[model samples]
Each structure stands twice: as structure tokens, then as C-alpha cells.
Target: MPYATAPDTTRIAYQVRGQGTPLVLLSGQANDHHWWDTVRDDFHPARRTVTLDYRGTGMSDKPDRPYSTEGFAEDVIAVLDDLGIGRADVYGTSMGGRVAQWVAVRHPHRVRRLVLGCTSPGGPHGVERDPAVSTALSDADPAAARRTLLDLMYTPAWQARQPGLLGRSTVLGDPAMPAHARRRHRLASARHDAWEALGHVTAPTLVLHGTDDRFNPTANAPLLAGRIPGARLHLIPDARHAYFEEFRTVASPLVLDFLGAP
Candidate 1:
């Protein structure tokens, strides 16, 4: 329940766990730290994991104002500064990944390593998600939105095994989140364009995605990997948007190796 004050004077809530080299985990779209609930344990004990709710989500202040990936990145840096953490490994997924790009580019000295998952560089050069997917995800009906979000995230087999995943998956346009905040999150994410600034990232980077991902096209992985100097790309075959959670058995070990897990 600890909090940090963003430059805008907005209060950002964050949580810290374990005790080792800091690892910052960023959430996607309109979601909060709960987005990492499933994969967090994979890095526990070996790293001091940090998770936060963006200014518009979770336990943070929800302001009726403009938001951008750079702004979100600043919020993250503010949290780190509050914690007295000078630098740390960063892992961001979906919109969070886009925010991480800005963090690495604008604040190079503060990132030890970077992991971008199921995300895009944005603008014209990036491969965008299908408009239908967006339409379905942003459906006015909460139940329909949840169904679409779950479908886009996990495969049928995976969904079948996890009986109530649809109920639990409430990141994007869930009714629990304020409508204004969700719009802000979507707008902030849509405006993210990091392709031009990616070259400045000096941290060892990993760009990963699920091959079958439709939410954030898998094609963006190679584009990101190629743009960033020395960045590596990994695609989980047959995995969808929730690859990190569905295929953790493979994804976790690979990321752990790259992070030099203790």
C-alpha cells in the first residue's frame, strides 16, 4: 500500500516484495499490479519484485487529464526514486511495454535490463491490433468485453482448464475501473510511439510475444528486437496474448536465464 508522488503531484501506489536486485514489473493498459499476479512468483526470492498501479488504476489517483507513455514512465521513475532505488531491471507487457521503452530511452541510467512483452513500438511503423479486437474489447457491455478480453488472451484449451479466467480477466475495459480512467489508459496507449527513441536504449533487452497473439501482434517482436541495439526476440509458438501466464513453464525459465536468476 506504499505510494509515490508523481511529478504531477499525483499519488502512485506500489508494492515491494522479496529482497535482492530490484525488478520492476509494469502492468498493461488499464490494469494495475494484479496483472502480474500469475507470473510474479516466478521471479520471487531471486529478485526484489516491485509492482505499481498506474495513476489511473488500482489504488492510485485517477485524474481527469491527459496521459502519455512518457508520463507513465515518469510515474514509474518517481516510484523508484521514492524507494531509493537508483536502477532496476524492468519488465513491461502490452501498454506497459511501451512505457518501459520511454523509461529506458529517457532515463537510460535507471534501467539495468529491459523486457518488453506483447507490445508495439506504435505509430505507422508498428503492427497494430485488429480493429475488430479493439471493438470487441471496448464493447459497451461488460460481460461481452470480458469474454472478448479472455478470448484474445488465452486459447480455448487454456481457458477450458482455467474455469473462471473470464471472470478474473478484467484489465482492459472492466466495469470495476472508472470509464474515464479506462479511456485515459486507452488513449495513452494508443498515442505511444517509441520506435524513434528505441535506439537510445542501452540496457540488455528482451522482446517477447506469443505467436498467436492478436491483441498485440506477434510480428512486433522482431521489429522491436531489430530496432533496439543488441535486443533479443522470443516468440512462444501457439501461445496467445497471455503467453507468460499460459506458457510460464517455458517463458519463465527463458526470462530467468536472461535476467541471470540466482
Candidate 2:
């Protein structure tokens, strides 16, 4: 229930677990700290994991205004500063990656290492999500929405083989991120343009993506790695946007290794 106040005075609720070098986690669009519920424990006892609710989601304040990726980046800094964490390794997925990109570029001193997963630098050069995937994200029926996400996120073969996985996994639904917030997040993400600014990032970076990702194509991975000096790229075959969820055995180890966590 700890809260960090952003410059705009928005309170960001966060939680810290385990014991080791701080590892700040930023979730995707419309997602809150709960997004990390499943994989978070894997990093415990080796790396301290910090998860937070983005503004307009979870326990944070929801302002009726436009949002920017830069503002989200500042939110992360506020959390770190409030915790007295000088620097921490950061892992940002999907939209979170966009925010993290800004964090690395604008506040290089606050991040030691960066992990951008299933994300892009944005702007005209970035690939767009499949129409079906976009429709699913905006679907009204809860069950239908979940189905759409499962289909777009996990490979079909994997879905058929492990039908129970979705039920057993941590809930991905966010009732707190209402229609207004979702639209605000989407609007902010649409304006994200870190393509040219990536060069300013000094943190060692790792870009992870799945070849079968329907939400964000794998081609963007190399684009990010190429732009950020010394960044490494890793691609998982047959894995989709939720590769970290379905292929945790493979993805977790890769992340742990990259972060040098035991």
C-alpha cells in the first residue's frame, strides 16, 4: 500500500518484495501492479522486485485528462526516489517499455539496466497492432475480451495444449482501468516517439520479443536494440506477446541471466 507522489501530485501505489538489487517492474497499457503477480515470485530471493500501479489504474488516482509516456516515466522516478533507491534495474513490457524508454533517456542516472519486452520505440516507423488484436483490446464482453487476449497473446498450439493455463494464471483483467483511462493510455501511447531519443540512453539494455507476437511484431526488437548502443536482442520462437507467461521457463531464465541475478 506504499504510495509515491509524482510531480503532478498523483499517488502511485507500489509494493516491494524479496531481497537483493532493486528490480523495478512497469506493466503494459491498462495494467496495474497485479500484472506482475505471476512471474514476480520467480525473481524473489535473488532480486528485489518492485511493482506499482500506474496512474489511472489500481489504487492510484485517476485524473480526467490526457496522459503522456513522459509523465509515466517521471512516475517511476518518483517511486525510486521515494524509496531512496538511487538506481535499479528496470523491466518494462509492452506500453510499459515505451515509458521505460523515456526513463532511460531522460533519467539515465535512475536506471542501471533496462529490459524492453514486446515493446517499440513508437512513431511512424513502429509497426501497428493487428486489427483483430486492437478490436479485442476494446471488446466489451469480458469473456470475449479474455478470449481475444488469449488468442492474440499465446500461440494457438500452446493454447490448445494447455487449455487450463489461462484459468490458473494470475488475473490480467483490470476493472480499475475504465474506458476513459484506457482511452487516455492509448492516446498517450500513440504519441510515444522515442526513436531518435534512444541514443541518449546510457543504461545497458536488453530487448526481448516473441516471433509470434500479434500485438507487437518481433521485427521491432532489433530496431530497439540497434538504436540503443550496446543493447542485446533475444527472440523466442512460437512465443506470442505473453511469452513471459506461457514460456516462463525460458523467458525467466533469460531475464535472470541478463540481470545477473542468481
Candidate 3:
């Protein structure tokens, strides 16, 4: 229930769990802190995990304008400032990775290390979601939107095991999300192209992707790894876009090793 006031004065909601070096987690588009519910406990007990709900999602105050990736990165900084966390490791997934990349470029001193998961460099070569799936997400029915998201997010095996994952869709379907906010998010996402900005990021980086990701192709991972100096890439086999959920056993250990390494 903690809230941080952004420069625009929007109250962004965030939650902090566990205890150790601070690690801020930025969730993907249409997702909130709840996306980390399953893996929150997987990090080292000594490592603090901070999960945030972007302006229009979860318990955060929704605003009418300024929903760019740059805006979201500012929101993350405001949360860190509120908590007196001067510098921390950052982990971002999908859209969150875009924000993380911006943070690394714009506020390099504030991030010690960076982890980009299921994300792209966001240029002409950046992978795009299938039009059908994208259309389904903007549907009026919450159920339809959730189904579309799940279909785009997970592999068949993950969906079969967690048939009820879409039940959590109500968080995104909240009435607080105005039509304009949704439209702005879509516009920002579509227009986002960070390839030009990648060379500006100086943080030690890690890129994680799934071999079978349908939403964003795994090939994008190697492209990113090749672009960022000293960056390492890891691809999970049989995993889809949502590898964190589908292959937690493989994913968690890899993350822990990378994050906890001396």
C-alpha cells in the first residue's frame, strides 16, 4: 500500500518484500506487482525485492496523459527516492525492460546492474506481437483481454498447468484505467524504439529470453546481447515468452546466480 509521488504528482503504488540489497522489479505492460507473486520468494532472503504498479495499473493513481517509457522510468526513480534507495539493481520484463534501459541510459549511477527479460531493443528489428493477439487485448470484455494476454504470454504447457491464471485479470480491468490511458499506453508501446539508445547504456547487463517465445522472438535476445558491451545472454529451452512462470526452476536459478554472483 505504499505510494510514491512522481514529479507529475501521480501517486504510484509499490510493495517491498524480503531484505537485502535493494532490487527493484518493473513488471510488463498490462501487469502489476502481482506478476511477481509466484517468484517473490525465490530471490535470496538477503536481497530486497521491490515491485511496483505503474501509474495506471494496480493500486496506483491513474493519470490522463504522459504514459511514455520515459515517464515510467521517472516513476521508478520516484519510488526509489521515496524509499531512500540511492542505487539498486534493476530487473525489468517486457515493457519494463524498455523502462530499465532508459533508466540505465539516463540515470546510470542509480542502477548497479540490469536484467532484461523477454524484452527487445525496440527498433525496426524489435519483435512485434501478432496483430490478432494485439486486437484481442484491446477488446471490451475483460475475459477476452485476459485470454488474449495469456495466449500471447505463455506456452501451451504453462497454460495447461495454470488454467486459472486469467482470473487475476481483474486487476488490469479496473475501472480506474481510463480509455485515454489505455490508448496512450498502446501508442507509447508501438512507437517505442530504443535501439538508438542502447549504446548509451553502460550498466553490466543480462538478457534472458525463451527459445519459443511467440510474443517476442528469442532471436532478439542475441541481437541485444551483441549490441550491449559485456552483456550475457541466456535462453531457456521449451519456454515461451513468459519463461519466468513456465520454467521457474531453470529461470530462478539462473537469475539468482547472475544477481548473487560476486
Candidate 4:
């Protein structure tokens, strides 16, 4: 477990693997680096991969306050500084994509390339969950929250294939998550609005979304692709929010091609 002390003195845990150009992987809401294991090998064989557990998510120290996107962004910069990495490509999904967007706008020189998956620019057009789902997420029982998340995360087919994965994921999430962290995560998410910042990003960008994504629709792909100069959009059909898991064979190759581009 490699740990870096953030400016706020919070210890962030991360893992580095492979070799070549550094590529940082940021997980989605409530998820850790394990979410990338499904597609890690697909990145260029020569590229180095860095995956970290956000402050409250995995092996990292969870603080009670300052869980804002700005705070998380600072944590990312702290990691780069600690590692002595001048710049690196970034791949972010869902909430992590929002962080990546912030990184590009705030520290443009540090990003070589950017990949946003199953995410949006966060504005009026951004996707929003049903009120019921949202309410369930804030419930006292972590299991209920987990079920609601699972419902929004994957399509019916995925649920059928992996019956107990959601329960297990929820159990793992409950112990690692603190109420304060969850509240902060929600606040950071609700307050996020990146539409105005898109034009500030100069890195080569790629947006990937699934046609059947209920949580964040495929329309978001174009919204993002259109906002970032030279950004390209790829839409996977018959896929849902968890497109990477449901369609890894297709998703991985597309990602590999995009990131491997010269």
C-alpha cells in the first residue's frame, strides 16, 4: 500500500504497475481502483498505470470534512507532486470524470491526455437519478443504498450474470465508507457544474458512453465531446451505466485504441 500525504495531511493510498508513460486511473463514486481491473490490461502494454483509493474509499485515511471536488482535486495534485510526476494521462469515470475535468481546467499542463467514461459535464442537461433512488442512497442501511446503486449501475442482464456481486459490493462499501464521507461525496456531486469549464481544457479528450446508460445517458457523450476541443465520442450500443463491466471486450479495445493514439 503506497501512501502519499495530501496537503491536508490525509494519507491517500495508491498502487502503481506496468511501465512507460504514466496513466492515472480515478474511480467512480463509492468505488476504488478495483473497478479498473476489468480493463487495466487493455491499456497500451508499455504504459504505466497508477490507481488510487480516494481518501474515504479504500485503504486511505478518511477525514470527516473537506470532501469537496476541489479537495479531491488537490489530493490528486498532491499525489503527482509526491511521486515527482511532471505530467500524466488521466482516465476517469463517473464522479472521477468530474475530477479529471477539474484537473484539466485547473492544471492543464499536467494532463497529457484525458478519458471520460460514463460521465457528464454537470449542468441542466446532466443526468439525474429518480428521487426514490436518491432517497434510498441516503438511508441508514448500507445494504439498501447498495441495492439502489446496483440498480442504477448495471442493466438487468448484468445483474442476472452476477447475482450476489451487488450484495458483496455493498457490504464492502459499508465498512469502508463513513457517514460523513458519504455526505461530503453527495455534496461534492450535487454542487458540481463543469459546463463552463469545458472550453478551458486543452488536452486531447475522449468521451465514452453507453446507449442504454440510465444513470448518465449517451447524450452526455456528445455534450462533452462537443465542449472539449478535438474531443471524440464513442457510444456503445445495448450497454448501460456499467458498460465497462457488461461489455469489457468491446469497451477495452475502444479505450486502448483511444489512449494508444499518438
Candidate 5:
């Protein structure tokens, strides 16, 4: 229920849990602060985790205008400033990863380390999602949207074996995203081009992806690690776009180690 006021006068809802060095968690496009619930617990014990609703999502103010990664990045800084956190580690997934790039590049002194999961630099060099996957993401029906996304998020075997886990992802079902907001986020994601600016990031970085990511192509992982000096790339086998969720047991430890958690 906590909120931070952005410089533009928009209210951003955020949550702080556990206690340690700040670790901000940024969710993917169209998802709210709740989307990080799947992996939230893993970081909470060893880190003071912060999660927020992007401008057009969750409890945050939903402006009907266009959105940009840079704007999203500012929202993050606003939340951190409100919390009195001068610097923090960041973990960004999918579209959130693009925004994190801006945060590290534009606000270099504010990031201690960075983690980009299932995301890309997002430019001419990035690989686009499959046409079928893109169509599913644009579906209006909430149930249909969940089904399509779950299929792309996890592999067939994993889904079959983890039926209960699927229900966890459906917690935020009512009043699904409107068409306009969805398109705005999509456009914002598409217009992100940080390939040229990535080298400016001085924070130690970790790039993660699943071998079978259906949304952002897996190849984007290497491109990110290669471009950022000293960045390491880790690929999860038999996982998809939601690799962090599907392989949290493995992913969590890797992230904690990178963050120097005990």
C-alpha cells in the first residue's frame, strides 16, 4: 500500500520487505508488483527487496499517454529516493530489464550491481518474439491471455508436472489490462534501444535467460553479456521465458551469489 511520488506527479505503489541492502525487483510489461511474488521470497531473507507498480500497471497511476523505458527508469529512481536508498542492486525481467539498463546508464551512481533476466538490449540487434506469441499477448480475454502466456512461459513437461504452480500466476485476474495501456507498454518496450548506451554501465552485471524462451529470443542473452564489459551470461536448460519462476531454486542461488549474499 506504500506509494512514492514521481517527479511528474504520478503515484507509484511499492512494497519493502525483509531487511538488508536494497534489492529492487522490476516486473515485466503489463505485470504489476504482484508478478514478482513467484520469486520474491527467495530474495527477502537476505535482502531488503523493493517491488513497484509501473505507471500504467497495478496500484500506480495509469496515464493514458505513451510510455517510455526512460520514463519507467525515472519511476524506479523516484521510489528509491523516497525510500532514502542512495544505491541498490536491481533485478529486471523482460521489459523491466530494458528499463534497468536506463537506470544504470542514466543514474550510474545509484546501482551497485545489475541482473537482467529473460530480456534484451532491444534494438535492431535484438531478436523479436514469434508472431504467434505476440498475438497471444494482445488477446483481450483474461483467461485466454493467461493460458497463452503460461504456455510460452513454461515448457510442456514442467507445466504438466506443476499444475498447482500455474494457479499461483493467476492471482491477479480481475480487470485485466486495457487495450490502450497494453499497446503503450508494448510500444515502449519496442522503442527501447540501449545497445549503444550499455557500455556506459559500470555496475557488475549478470544476464540470464532460458534456452527455450519463447518471448525474448535466447540469443539476446549473449549479445547483452558480450556488450557489457565483465558481464556474465547464464542459461537455464529446459526452461522458458519465466525461467526465474520455473527454475527459482537454481536461479535464486545464482543471483544471491552475484549480489554477495550470505
Candidate 6:
């Protein structure tokens, strides 16, 4: 129920859980903090997890104005400032990775470590998803077309064992937003251009991706890792866009170790 005020006077909603070293989690486009509900506990008991709703989603203020990854990063800083967290480990996936890029670039002092999953350093350097994937992203109704998304996100075997998780796992849905809010979120993400500024990230960074990710593709991960000094890239073999959820058994411990958590 806590809120942090952004420079534009927007209030970002955030939540904290567990009781150890702080870790801020950024969700993908159009998703709120709940996007991490399933995977969050994996880092807990030894690490505190902070989750927030971007301006256009969940309980945050949805303004009738433009949204940029830079602005979203400011919202994140606002939350950190409100909580008096000087610096913390940051983990972002999908569009959240774009915002995290700015967080590291613009507020380098605020991030002690960074993890980018299934994301890209935008502009001309980043690879685009295939036309079919773009079509699926644009045309599908996330609410009614659950199976289509489930097929796009998780492997058939994983989906079978983790039945009905598509409702909670996918990043494209935000039931609380109006049409314009969703459009703003998409536009901000599509326009993200961090390619030129990634080298400025001072924090130790990890770039992760799923080899079979049709949505963002695996190629982008290397680009990010290569561009950021001292960054490392790790690909989850045979995993897809939702690998953070599907491959948590393989990915979570890796993250914990990278952050030096217990």
C-alpha cells in the first residue's frame, strides 16, 4: 500500500517482502509487481525483494501523458529514495530491462548490481522479433487468448506441469489500465534507445536470455553483455521468453550467486 512520488508528481506503488539485502524487481511492459509473484520467493529469506507498479499499470497513477523508459527509471529512483535505499541489486526482464538500463546509466549510484533478462538495448543495434511474433503481440487478446500466449512463452512440457500459470506469468496484461495507458506503455518500450549509453553502467551486470525466446530473441543478450563493461551473458538453453519463470530452477540460484546472497 506504500507509494513513492515521481518528479512529474506521479505516484508509483511498490511493495517489499522478506528481510535481508534489498533487491528491486522490475516487471515487463504493461505488467505490475504481481508479475513476479511466482518467482519472487525464490530470492527471499536471505534477500529482500521490492516490486513496483509502473505509472500505467496496477495501482500507480496513470497519466494522460507520454511515457519514456527514462521516466520509468525516475519512478524507480523515486521508490528507492522514498525507502532510503542508497543502492540495491536490480533485476529487470523484458521492457523492465529497458528501464533498468536507464536506472544504471542515469542513476548509477543507485544500483549496486544489475540483471537484464530477455531484453534489448534498443535503437538500430537491437534485433527485432520475427513478424509472426510481432503479429502475435499486437493482435492477440491477452485475456481470451491465453493459450496463444502460453504457447509463445513456455514450452509445451513446462506448460503442462505448470498449468494455468499463463494467467499470472505473462507480461502483456494489466487489467486495471485503460486503452491509452496500455498504448503508452507499448510506445515507451518500443522507443527505448539505450544502445549508446550502456557503457556508462558502473554496476556489475549480468545479461540473461532464453535461447528459444521468440519474443526478444537470444541475440540481444550478447549485445547487451558485450556493450556493458564487465557484463556477463548467460543463456538458458531450450528456454523461451518466460524462462525466468520456466527455468527458475536453473536461473534463480545463478542470480543469487551473482548477487552474493545466501
Between prediction 3 and prediction 4, the one with superior TM-score is: 3
**Candidate 5 local distance difference test against the native:** 0.88
Query: Please, what are the lDDT tens digits per residue for candidate 1 over residues 180-212?
Result: 888988899998888889999999999989999
**Candidate 6 displacement at residue 152 in angstroms:** 2.0
- TM per candidate comes to 0.96, 0.93, 0.91, 0.90, 0.93, 0.95
TM-score, structure 3 vs. true: 0.91
lDDT values, one for every candidate = 0.89, 0.87, 0.81, 0.80, 0.88, 0.89
Model 1 lowest lDDT segment of ten: 167-176
Q: Tally clashes: model 1.
A: 0
The C-alpha stretches of model 6 lying farther than 4 A from their native spots are: 140-146, 166-172
Q: RMSD in Å for candidate 4, one decimal?
A: 2.3
After superposition, which runs of candidate 5 have C-alpha atoms over 4 Å from their true positions?
136-145, 164-167, 170-175
> Candidate 1 — which residues are off by over 4 angstroms?
170-175
- Which candidate model has the greater TM-score, 1 or 6? 1
Higher-ranked by TM-score: 3 or 5: 5
By lDDT, the better pick of 3 and 6 is 6
Candidate 4, number of clashes: 0
lDDT of 3 by residue, 199-254 (tens): 87788899999887777777889888887888999998878767886688998888
Q: TM-score for model 4?
A: 0.90
Give the local distance difference test score of model 1.
0.89
Q: In order, how many clashes per candidate?
A: 0, 0, 1, 0, 0, 0
Candidate 6 is scored at a TM of: 0.95
lDDT of 5 by residue, 1-262 (tens): 9899998899999999999999999888888888787679898778999989888887888889989999999999999999999999999998889999999999999999999999999889888888988888669886787788788888788788876755677323214667687779889999999999999999999999999998789999999999998898999987798888878899999999999932
